[model samples]
Target chain A: MAGHNESGKKKSSEAANDLQTFSAENLQNNMKVIYYSQTFLSIVGGVIAGILGFKGLAGFILYFLIMAISSVGLIAKAKFSVHSYFDCWNRIIFDGFFGGLMSFVLFWTFAYDIVHIF
Target chain B: MAEDLVLDTAIRDWVLIPLSVVMVLIGVLRYFVSKLMRSYQVPDAKIVKEGQVIVRARNLRSGANFIPPKAFRARRVYFSNEENGLLFVPKGQAQNAQAQMFSDPNMAMDMMKKNLSMIIPQTLTFAWVNFFFSGFVAAKIPFPLTQRFRSMLQNGIDLSTVDVSYVSSRSWYFLNLFGLRGLFSLILGEENAMDDTQRMMQMSGFGFDPTKSLSAEKDSLDIIQHEWALPKFEQRAEAVLRKLVS
Candidate 1:
C-alpha cells in the first residue's frame, strides 16, 4: 500500500505540472466528438444499406459491421496506441457504439423505405 | 409476409431530401448562432489565486518524495502548518469566489443568451416541421418496436392498419437533430454548439456545473492527509544500486 501510495503521488505530481487532467467533463467533451463522428458514419451506412435493399436483421448487422470498421479507423487514427485512448475514454467507446446502433436503425429504415419503396 | 406499399418518387424529392437538407442547414446555423452568443468573461483574480494555492499544495504533497529529506520536511511543514499553512489559508475564499461567479450579472446574462440561442432555433424548427410535415409517415423501421414508442415515433400519424414502426416526418426531424452531431463536427470542427442534444442536457442540469465542481475540489482538498515519502528514499535507491553492482 505504501509503495502504491508513493507511485500515486509521483504520478499526481507529474499531473500537477500538466494543466489538463483526465477530468470527467473533458472526457465527456472528447467522447461527444467521437460519438458525433460515429453517428454520422452510422447514418451514412444506414442509407447505403437502405439503398442496397438490405432489410430487417441483415440491415442491422450490416450497419453495425460498418460501424466496427469505423472503430478500427478511429484506432488507426490513434496509430493503434489504444492504451492512451482507453485511459482517457474507457466507457465512451461503448456508449458511442450502442448509441450509434440505435440511430443507425432509424436512419437505415428511413433511407431504405425512401429509396426502395419509391 | 406483409405487402410493401410503393411510394412515389416525388416523396423523396419533396419530403426526405428537403427535410434532411433543412436539418443540416439548421444545425449549421445554430452552430454559428451559438458561437456569436458565447460570452468570454475574464476570470476573477481570487479564483485564480485559490486555484494556484490548491495546485501548489498538491505539488508539495506529490513532489516532496522526490526531493531530499531536508527540503521535503521544510515544504511539508510550510504547507501543513495549521496557523499560516498555504493549504488552509482563508478557508472560505474559494467558496466566496465561487458564489460571486454564480451571482455575477455577466454570467447570468451570458447564460440567458446561451439558453435563448439554444431554445429559439429549436422551437422554430420544431414548429416549422410540425406545421409543414405533420401527418406523413416519412419512414418505416425495418425492425419492430414496442407499443410505447408508437406515440413518440409516429407523432402526427395514427392508423390502426399501419404498423407501429412507421415514424412521422416531425420525428424524423427530431431524430436528425440528435444524429447530426457528426456532420456538425465535420463542418464546424469539434466543440461547436450545434450539438442540440448536449445543449438540452446542460439546460436540464446534466452537463458541467462549475460552482459544484469548485466546492467538490475544496472538499477533497480538505480531507487530504499529506504523508512524507522521503524518509526511506535513500534505502530504496541504495538497494537499486546494489542490485546493479551485483
Candidate 2:
C-alpha cells in the first residue's frame, strides 16, 4: 500500500508537469489575441468614458468594468472551458490587463481633453 | 481648487491635432522603412534541422507517458544514443559554432542596421518635437495626479503654480510615443517593428543560443522514465462505468 501511494504521488507529479508543458507558438498566439482584444476594448471604453464625462474614480471603475466584461466574453467565447485554450484562469482574465491600461489612459485623456476640457 | 485655465482652441487644432497625426504617420513610416531595411537571410539547413530535432525531443519528453513503452524507448534511443544520436554534438564543433556566430561580419552589420533604424528616427523625432512644439502647455489630463508627477507631465514648462495634470507638448510627444503601441499593433499586425520597447529589449541581448538549449533538452530527455498510462486510464474508465451501471 505504501509503494502504491508512492507510485501514485509520482504519477500525479508527472501529470502536473505535463499540464505545464504548452506549445510555445500556441501560447504566443493566445496571448496575442488577448492583447489585441484588450487593446480594442480599452480604447472603446476610454472613448465612452470621455464622451460621458466620467470623473477620476468613475473613469477607472469603467475601465475595470470593461476589462471584466471582456474577460467574461473571452471565457464565453472559449465555451467556458478555458483550460483547453489557456494555461490558467489568470491567462484569460488578467494576462494583458496592465498592458492595456496605458493605452486606455492615453485615449481617455485625449478624448476627455477634446470633448470636455478644450 | 484654483481657477481652471482656458487653453486656446488653436492649440488643439495646431499643436495637438498635428502632433498626433504626425506621430502616427511617422510610426507607419518607420514600420515600412524597417521592413524595407530588413535583409532576409536564409538560415543554414543544419541549424534548422537542429532546431527541429530539439523541438521533437521536447515533444517526446512531454508526451512520453502517452505512447507505448516500446515506441517511447525507440524515440529516446534515436535522440539520446551516445554513439550516433542526433543530439550528440562534438565538443570542438559546439564551441566553434558560437565563435563563428560572433565573428561573422554579416551578423554585426545586421545588428548595426537594426540599431540605426531604431535610433535615427527616434533622435530626429525628439529634435523635431523640441524644435517645433516645446515650451507650452498642450493638453490637460482628466485624471488628477499627485505632485510627484509634476516633472514628468509638465516637461518643457516650468511653472510652480501649474497643476501636475497639465501636459506640455514635449511631454505629450513622449506620452504618445509609449501609448501608441496598442494603436500600432492594431494598425500593423502582431509582429510589426513599431514597438521601441521590444527593440530596446532585443538590443539588450536576449539572443537564443541553440547549443545551450540543445544540451538542456538532451539532458531532460535522458532522465524521462517512460511508463505508459493508457492501461491505467482504461481500467479507471471501466470501473467508473461499472459503478454507474450497478
Candidate 3:
C-alpha cells in the first residue's frame, strides 16, 4: 500500500516507472502470431456470418450468442481480483472491451448482411 | 459448309480458350490478393515493447523448513506479474533478496504450476470484434480509439516477469470517470506524476475525433481494449448468465 508514491505529474508509463525505482521495459519480440490469429478469427467470424445470413433470426442469434458469451468473460476478468489493493487494471478493462465489441460485431454482421443475403 | 465450320471453330478455340484463360486468371488473382491482404505484417524494424510486475508477499509459512508456516494459506490470487507485484515491501530490495534465497523450493514450484486451461483467452477473448470492427472494418473506415487496450501482458519469455502494457488515453479516461485518481492515491499512499499525460491527450483528442475531419476514427477494435469504469460487462451479462443462473 505504501508503494508507487512519487511525483504528481508525468506520462502513465513514466509515472509508473518512477514509482518502480527500477524500469521494466517490456519488450515483446514476436507479435505476428498474435495479430494473425486475431485477423484470422475475424475473417472466420465474418465468413460464418456470411453463410448464416440465410436465416435472419439465426444470424441474429449467432452473433448475439458469441458477443454475450464474450461480455460475460469480460465481466469475469474485471471482477477477478488477483490483488486486493491495486489490481491488473488494464487487464480487466481490455477484457471488457474485447468481449463487448466482438459481441456487438457478431450481431451487427448479421444485421447488416441479412438484407443482402435473404 | 463454311458457316458450320465457323461455328465449330468458335466453340473449340475462340470461346473456350478465352473462357479458360479468364477463369485461371481469376483464380490466381484471388489467391495472390488474399495472401497480400489477409493481414498486415509487422515490419522487421518495428519494435515490440513489454514489461512485468512482481506481486507482494502474502501469508507465508513460519516453520523451520522451507514451507508455508504451519498456517500457510492457499493464496487466493497471484500478481499479474510476480516480480512487479510487490504492493508492499517490508524492507528494501536487500530484505527481498534474502527472503527469496531462503524460501522453500517446493512452495515456489507449487506457485508456478497454474491451471492454464482456465486462463486461455482465445477467440471469445475479444468477443465483440464482431460488433464494432465488423461495422468499421466492413466499411474499411477508421474510428475513434475509445476502447481499453491490451498490450503483451506476458512476453512469454524468460518466465521471470509477466509484462503488461496499456494505452495512456484509456487509463486517463478511466481514472477521470470513476474518480480513480483517488483510488490510486489511497492505495499507493501518494500520487505518481501521471497528471499531465491526460491533459496532453485530451488536447489532441488522444488521436480520436471522427467529427473533426473526413479522416476515419479508430473503432473499438483498434487496440482490443475495454474499461470497468466504462461498464465492465455486468449490465450486458444478464443475457449470457441465463445458462448458469437458470
Q: State which candidate has the highest DockQ.
A: 2
User: How many backbone clashes does every candidate have?
Assistant: 1, 0, 45
TM-score of chain A of 2: 0.81
Q: Is candidate 1 or candidate 3 better by lDDT?
A: 1
Tens digit of per-residue lDDT, candidate 3, span A1-118 = 2122221222122212212121122211111112222323333444466544434455446545544443344345334432221224443233333433343343333333333311
- Return the top candidate by lDDT: 2
Candidate 3 residue runs with Cα over 4 Å from true position? A1-40, A54-61, A67-118, B1-246
The total number of steric clashes, by the backbone 3 Å criterion, in model 1 comes to: 1
Give lDDT tens digits, candidate 1, residues B171-208: 88877787665456556766674455556664565323
Best by TM-score: 2
Least lDDT summed over 10 consecutive residues: which range in candidate 1 chain B? B206-215
The CAPRI classification for model 1 reads as acceptable
Off by over 4 Å in 2: A1-27, B193-209, B235-246
TM-score of 1: 0.71
TM-score of each: 0.71, 0.87, 0.20
- Chain A TM-scores for all candidates read 0.69, 0.81, 0.31
Superposition TM-score, candidate 3 onto the true structure = 0.20
- Model 3 in CAPRI terms: which quality? incorrect
